[model samples]
Target: MTMQIRFEMPSDEALLLKDMAERFVADHYSLAQRSRMLAAPATELPAHWPRMADLGWLGAALPEACGGLGLSPQQVLPLIEVLGAGLVLEPVTPATLQCATVIARLLPEDRASDVLAPILAGQQIEVLVAGPDGMEPAVSARPVPGGWELSGTVRLVPGGAAAAAFWVAVDIDGAAVLRVPAAEAEVTAYRLLDGQAAASVCFDGVLCPPDACWTGARAALDAGAEMALFGALAETSGLVAALLRATLDHVKLREQFGRPIGRFQTVQHRLADMYICREEVRSMVQLAAEAMAGEASDKRRRLLSAAKVKTGDCARAVVRDAIQFHGGMGMTDELAVGHMVKRLLVLGQAGGTRAGHLTAFSAAS
Candidate 1:
């Protein structure tokens, strides 16, 4: 007798959104367009930002009360994966998922709507400065009668150059987060190896009103960090999948020893290994996404760290193998593999390095 295994599928809405994202990428995000986007001024996003807003992609993860579809992290995973496959250079992960989530969840109620509305509409960009330096209760804040003067530097802020504002963490008496206008800070912008924009923002006596600051933002920061980590995992999954497909295509087309290189037993074994790595990454991303939806913070952190470490490992292996299979051509900019490899390197270091996550996982246990 034969047995059948059944699994749950994504909702119709999720499937529709995934298909729309894939179609959007196929039509709008060609390699040339990606290059143009990278070369454009740091303050400008690609021309498609407004179009993405129109498609409700920008607001997909926000709560419905915040003018979004309120999609869960899991539901948004497929769309992120699609973006990854196309190597989309937009700051959707940093700006929307991480920064927006923090603002919506922790910002003062009176300030939330005004700040988030423009972001969801794609009219403004906000970046989070909550990495190690930003998280440290070290950014000095001095009382200046009605408001506080902030003086510190936040390094390696993703999407910082184009950001209209920043959710900056600071220390008054304890940990607090301040919403500071980008104009107030000295933003030194540069391109990451993956063609993404990053900046080091220095706030030398930047004044911030009391209303612009929120105290005890650690919980919110944790939530945003987890979301960012999940976004990286999702994108890495898509990148690995893309690399696998490209590798398979290359093996089938490249000739060696009077036949397709794919016919070689060793090549077939490598291809199989790549596929295995891709699936492992996908599974871990799904696990992390599911964990994020639950209320248990400890469990969520543990699982997210596990996912980050596994995804980084798999991404490294898959990219190395894909490049090897493609020979010298893989390292050239002419092919997508090299770009994907750079992105994998960036992603590995973005949320937290594999060693960092491993330590976190061990501590969590």
Candidate 2:
């Protein structure tokens, strides 16, 4: 039999989480609320953040031993997709899955708990500025009398303004990670194109105790990167689906020649193309999920890179076509399509540029 790729049916737990997330979005995360949040300072956490924690969202992906639910990657993918459809503002996956994975699996048990507890409770955040940038991991570090002195500037770190600590990758004989508290760095806070909180963090001879460093964190870094890739792909796929649905509804209601545009042959063709784009992305997300389930290897990296690259192209295609179908209304800031398009624009380039990921894919191959 020929091979087939499809979205696996979500587990009961994932279905439960997905329903909860949809309910949460419907009950609280309205388009109006999103607009208001966009108008506010990006550094101020959204009002619904604590509620996400209270609903067990923050601890959903972490292991019970690490103060998390320890759900599998597939089990959590639907929740991310649903949140993406709603355009939820919180960095739930990164703060919960990616950041927590690094902190819990790499740091000392006691220290990890200390850092992760507040994060899981929505009381604090920690971020890595180099997320999805695919840059050469760089944070200059040297042994000092009392500890290590680090010097480097990481720019445009998402969530950095509110982060309590930063997981900065350093080259010490090999790849390593330093858990530096946000207080130790000079952070210049700003907002991204998609209205996410961001900052440029600089370390000038910042001292760190030996206990704060995790040597040979290349594995930890790889694991974190995998989770980040999975979350981005899944979330963007959700956005693609939502945009497709919105565009479909618009076409059916829009009129041309005294008839619904969706009934016309041209609009029908466009909608079909958009639907195909959506399905392509959905398939790639499934591939990402499967790749994440396996071991961290060159093959896994290559597959994730391919999915990332494909997801970027398809997200843009759907958004561009959706805009075209909306007759310029999609471009208006007041519309959800406008905001979704902007977010997709950011996601399309933020994690890994097409060229960057292309190079990565080539190397992996």
Candidate 3:
């Protein structure tokens, strides 16, 4: 009875979105642009932020009334590939996929707009800090007379440096999920290896009002977290594609011996293996996306965990082989290959490590 999803074709809307995204990447993004952004990765704001909002990408997952396409995680999944391939650093996974999803799904219609509207308009950047398992243990929240007080610091918040606010949660006995304004916490900004701005936020007894807590959403945190995990998996799929393309081009060129190195049997075998890995990742990603979009079940959880493991292992192996094929240039920032590898490394560990995801897969099975 498990794994009954039929192989379906992409809908018109999904195809159109992919076409539009391809055009956007062609027109707006480049390796040189990524280099400039990489230099200033401590700030989450990108020059194309407004453009992404204008295209409704930031709100792509929210409901139609909320100025979005009401796209499910599976429907909007193609956009993640585009962002990853272009090396765009706009926090799509954190803001669009995670926080925006939680706000739209959990908050009342009236209140959801307050957070989602600004994000859709590119006026505010909100992110989630819920850990791999429900809530991060580093943060502690205790009930108070007026509301609640939160202490401790979370060392890593992807895209948190420029986050206008954070949808934070603590692993405690109650509905601890709530929004905290950036000013209320001390945010030390920095850059991730992937050139995305990040922060370590220290919340010293930050007071959270009763209205701020998402008590009803406490139980559904896992769903939101899974959506983000699926996004990472999708992005890594895109990165694998990029690495394959880059490696192919390099092999075709850069002559060695008397002819191109690509003519060598050993190089050809590696290329064939990389292509197979890419196809495997593509198939696994689709299955995982389908499973995640279905009703909540142990089957869905196991599929997602399997996907994380597959994508993570494949990304590492292929990227390593790609660097070897590219010679020394593969590790240099001058080439897109190296940057894509770095992103693959970071995203490969987005939800969980290979061993960790394997454990999850086993538990779910």
Best by lDDT: 1
Give TM-scores for every candidate, taking all chains together and pairing residue i with residue i: 0.94, 0.93, 0.95
- Weakest lDDT window of 10 consecutive positions for candidate 2: 129-138
Output the better candidate (2/3) by TM-score: 3
Per-structure clash totals for the candidates: 0, 2, 0
Tens digits of per-residue lDDT, candidate 3, 274-357, equal: 999999998888888888767466788788888888888788889999899999887787888888898898887677667877
Q: Candidate 1 — which residues are off by over 4 angstroms?
A: 1-8, 108-110, 132-138
Candidate with better lDDT, 1 vs 3: 1
| Model 2, position 129: C-alpha lDDT score | 44
Candidate 2: lDDT of 205? 76
- Where model 2 places Cα greater than 4 Å from the true spot, the runs are 1-7, 131-135
Q: lDDT per residue, candidate 1, 121-167, as tens digits?
A: 88878988865522454357888988999888876888888889988
Candidate 3 ranges beyond 4 A from true positions: 1-4, 133-137
Model 3, residue 277: distance off in Å is: 0.6
